[model samples]
Target: MKLHGTVPVMLLPFRADESIDEAPFRKQVDFAIEAGAVAVCAPGFATEFYKLSDPERYWVAKTLVEQTARRVPAFVSTGCGSAHATIEFSQYAESMGADGLMVVAPKWCALGVKELTAFYEAVCRSVKIPVMLQDADFTGAGLPAKLFVELAERCPNFRFAKLEVLLPGSKCAEIIHLSGGKLQVLYGLGGVAMMDGLAHGATGMIPGSALVEVYAKIFRLYGAGQVDQARALFHRLLPYLVFALQHLELAVGIEKRVLYRRGVFPSDRLREPTLHLDNDYQKQMDELVDAVIGLVNEVKAATATRG
Candidate 1:
């Protein structure tokens, strides 16, 4: 049930008119695996959860899991506007053979921590695989440590968490302590604070900035006992990542665009309500991708020289 690692939140592939595209979806899956993703995720947000109908969401989840085929763990987000809907998604995902679920908090109702505990306990009981508590940024709501601990203790599949809060330094440690360090923590904000999170006892990262290899370099180096080297690589990769989404209205759109500009995808498509980057912003993101690609090459060269 331990779920802490660099789980890439998949970017939904859409066509020019913004409908789902299957070709690039398969490619994205292959790319992440080849790059050594610990897991591949299809969160509601990553797959444009907003616009998808319940059936659509299930179909997407089913196909993604089928395609991955146990090559990596699959975490599909199961947060809906209601606890009932969330439970539905969770149970359905488990039935579809997903290894685990990422249950985000309710956005509209904005339940308190006590309510959240009840919610998680119910959903976790409903499923057989692990569940990752995703109580991050949803209309000023956060999952406090007490509730997390309660859920982890009572819920059957409750094991991991994805902390997406914006709170500054050492706040993560506070949550860990509050949870008695029993919960497995993953940094879902990608590369930001990954090093700090690791130092504070986080198990792994779910970095969206890792469409390429620089992100992998850091994770590998850090895992292989090269702490100082990983830190330096993360710092070098950070600016390029920050720049890619700096001026974009929707960061997901920027991420997809970065992949597109690199020719990883022919069309930098986004589902409706997720607009394309403005022309100038697009150009800026292109430059950012160029830098990231360059960073990967530099690291590869450095590694080769050491060898």
Candidate 2:
């Protein structure tokens, strides 16, 4: 089966003193699985990947693979500025039994298509598992449709692409059409455009892990042809989704805080220099969740019925 559905970009839990809180992090993974996520991904942007050291990065990947233990696919972001480090991390993830890898374009300098393609080709060549290109405008090196097509055609392992752009539905559709459905497309942006992306032929989504059950409901409802129901749920989720995307750098902190509020995370403490919402924003998020409680319960009923 393809790696599909609400694959959460997990948040790394932290202790009061800023240490990695391993226990809560693992439980967060279990919570996502119990909530019906088709796969679990970690050390993505939401996981504070940039803040993690080399050893910490490997530990997160290792822990995710071990905890998931094949319950669902496990993917880790292994992109680095140089091909050698990328390959090293990619191979390490494969060694640790990761199901696949998500790689963004090399950073610090914008390179031409030829250099970008060569970078991806090198990483794909070094690993046997599938590789996903993370196409995000924030990366300053978003893959154009043509370059994406070339990567798909040139690398057999290049089988998935996750788009993090505005108005992603058309881009999602174009990728699906241009790649002949050979490359499965997913969208991010806290799933604000999830329904639109799905309608445009995205196979699935990879949103933050705060409310995996809700996202799972949307994905399952849509796939089951309950289009109207899915749209309703997606709209219900927009308040929090909008809040989550308010600041690009603060997205992970917002997710961690929500998870903490939901009791899925031990604490919302993040590494230094991350944002923390004040009481006002917290009250807003609380109200948003309150408004959606009924819909959330309805999703539970719907999921049980479908099962």
Candidate 3:
């Protein structure tokens, strides 16, 4: 399937006791689809994949694929620390009907190009569905464009890239150019550089699920040549993106809080080893949400009316 447009990485809803809340989890899936998301993703970094047990991860992948029910693409993040494990999970996701797989290299230690290439090749070869390489290096030194081109040539299923570096425009341009337009690029990093990435030829964005409709509006506006309006709307929401992305754990916590406030989630309970939002941070988050909640509600209403 062609993966494009705003595909939000879903927040895993939890009850006050910290167990996975299945009812709200399914509600979130329906909410994203109703809000105009082209696709939905799960167990991403934003979903706190590291904190989940293996069974929970598999359950999440199964639940997302089942819940999406082919209404839109459901891409599962299956990047384990070992190539063997990654391939195992990828196969499982494919069997569970995931439309695609998003794989990130092991972040515990830096692997050379040869090792990384081998790892990705094995994964692409293992699954029949398309694979999206997630270049999530916070240091901004992501894998080389040459490696991406070579992988695309070698693995016919390696058709997409999710660029999550510090600044992704240049890398997006380089990869698209090098891959002869065969590799579709999507931008992450909470869609902070979304406008820039679009200007550089990114096909889509994978942002958090709290504001899927808002991002969809910005994307549609830009695609319709309403650049100025898109810019204005994106700028209005930039502060919240910047605030939430200050840290990974902070992003997860804040996004859950936003979902809770929106009534998509019943509670904003995060798993352990999480960054607790202090009172000052909570106050600031409340203020930022206050600034954008109206726009969010407006977009949701318009989308529902159109649908």
lDDT per residue as tens, model 3, 136-229: 9876668988899999999999999998887778889999999999999999988999999989999899988988889999988999999999
TM per candidate comes to 0.89, 0.93, 0.97
Whole-model lDDT, candidate 1? 0.73
lDDT of 3 at 56: 95
14-132 per-residue lDDT for model 2 (tens digits): 88788899998999999899887888887888888888899999999999999998999999899877899999999999999999999987768978889988999889999999998
**What lDDT would each prediction earn against the true structure?**
0.73, 0.84, 0.90
Clashing pairs in 3: none
Worst 10 residues of 2 by lDDT: 136-145
Measured with C-alpha atoms, the lDDT of residue 270 in candidate 2 is 80
Off by over 4 Å in 2: 138-141, 292-295, 301-307
Clashes of each: 1, 0, 0
Candidate 1 regions with alpha-carbon error over 4 angstroms = 138-141, 168-171, 178-181, 209-212, 244-249, 275-278, 300-307
Off by over 4 Å in 3: 301-307
Q: Best-fitting candidate, measured by lDDT?
A: 3
Candidate order by lDDT, decreasing, is 3, 2, 1
Sorted on TM-score, highest at the top, how do the candidates line up? Answer: 3, 2, 1
Error of 2 at 217 (Å): 1.2
